[model samples]
Target: MNTQPDAPRHVVATSADADTVLRRLAREGWTARSGFALPDPAWDVAAHRIVLHGRIADDDTETVALAVLAAARGAGVVAVCDPESAAGRALIDDLSRIGAVHRGTDGADPVASLIPEQRALLDRLAAGDTIAAAAAAEFLSLRTANRRIAEARALFGVRTTREAVLAYLRQRQPE
Candidate 1:
């Protein structure tokens, strides 16, 4: 396992998402490879990228992919799937929340910005509960809750939890 704290991260939650991103990247003249395992022998992540596709709920695929990620270090890993599927959504959300810090990119994608638990708390807040109340409902300590709220605020580029909530809502609003 590479065990490096900073690594590039990428994910496409559906085959369609994969197609769209890949097409765009290709248009930008980037090279990519799609597969179930890491590229053999040697691969330059900065120059070449890999996309992993399949149901995460399927037999041990996620586990293996995680192992591969650990070994590959700087390589970009894209999880491609059908986001409409429950498993796909879960995978995307999970990856988004955890992978954001590792992406090494300038700005975070709002959709993948929060972990499910944080999002749940935000949902409660959006429904009009006080921050303390929402934190209590989620069984988080006041300190931990505040930490998560702060993290969410930083992720969304806002100063207050309410602003974060509004930003989240705006992001989710349909165009």
Candidate 2:
């Protein structure tokens, strides 16, 4: 079991809003030892506990992807975003629905047969992008994205995007 005590150093991505939040938290005398890194290390299982609000530029999509990665690594990451903003609302909604990151590779990597589009779709979704948004990011129509998901589901032997996400992460494939 992880015996590391929670450090006062919370994780933050490179963004204006994130900077603002970090300032406030510093003033509040919380996470006084705050630190940062490129997304993967910052969100690693050994990294900080909470991923404060704002997009992670390191994620390429400028979304709260590092936060999702942290959560997937079982860090119990918490994100706070403006409910009025569409992106924030999506994070609030989607984060709640994602399951714990699973452990695979004890079997074949389920994502092995997936086409590049399917992999791209899951990557965006795992980064907290909505399906339509993920679709657009990959230059695919909503219909095509959904079709990719359906096809990927068969390849991964999963029923939903969420399931496919967990399966994909199970391999710890680089972000």
For this target, which candidate reaches the highest TM-score against the unseen true structure?
A: 1
Model 1, residue pairs in steric clash: 13-81, 14-81
Off by over 4 Å in 1: 1-16, 19-33, 36-75, 84-90, 93-97, 101-115, 127-132, 141-159, 171-175
> Where's the lowest-lDDT run of ten residues in candidate 1?
97-106
Q: Show the lowest summed lDDT stretch of 10 residues, model 2.
A: 98-107
Work out the TM-score per prediction: 0.50, 0.37
Cα error of candidate 2 at position 164, Å: 0.8
Q: Write the per-residue lDDT of candidate 1 for residues 1-175, one digit (tens) a residue.
A: 5343333334444566556655655565555555545555565343344434332443444644563453254444445444446655554444543344221123346646466667777889889998889889999888777777776787787898889999888776453
Clashes of 1: 2
Across 1-175, the per-residue lDDT of candidate 2 in tens digits comes to 6674432212222345355555654564434222222344443444344433333232232455555544455344333344335544444333433332111211144454355577788889889999999998889899878877875665577888798888877865564
Please list all clashing residue pairs in model 2, or write none if there are none: none
Local distance difference test, each candidate: 0.56, 0.51
Count the clashes in each prediction: 2, 0
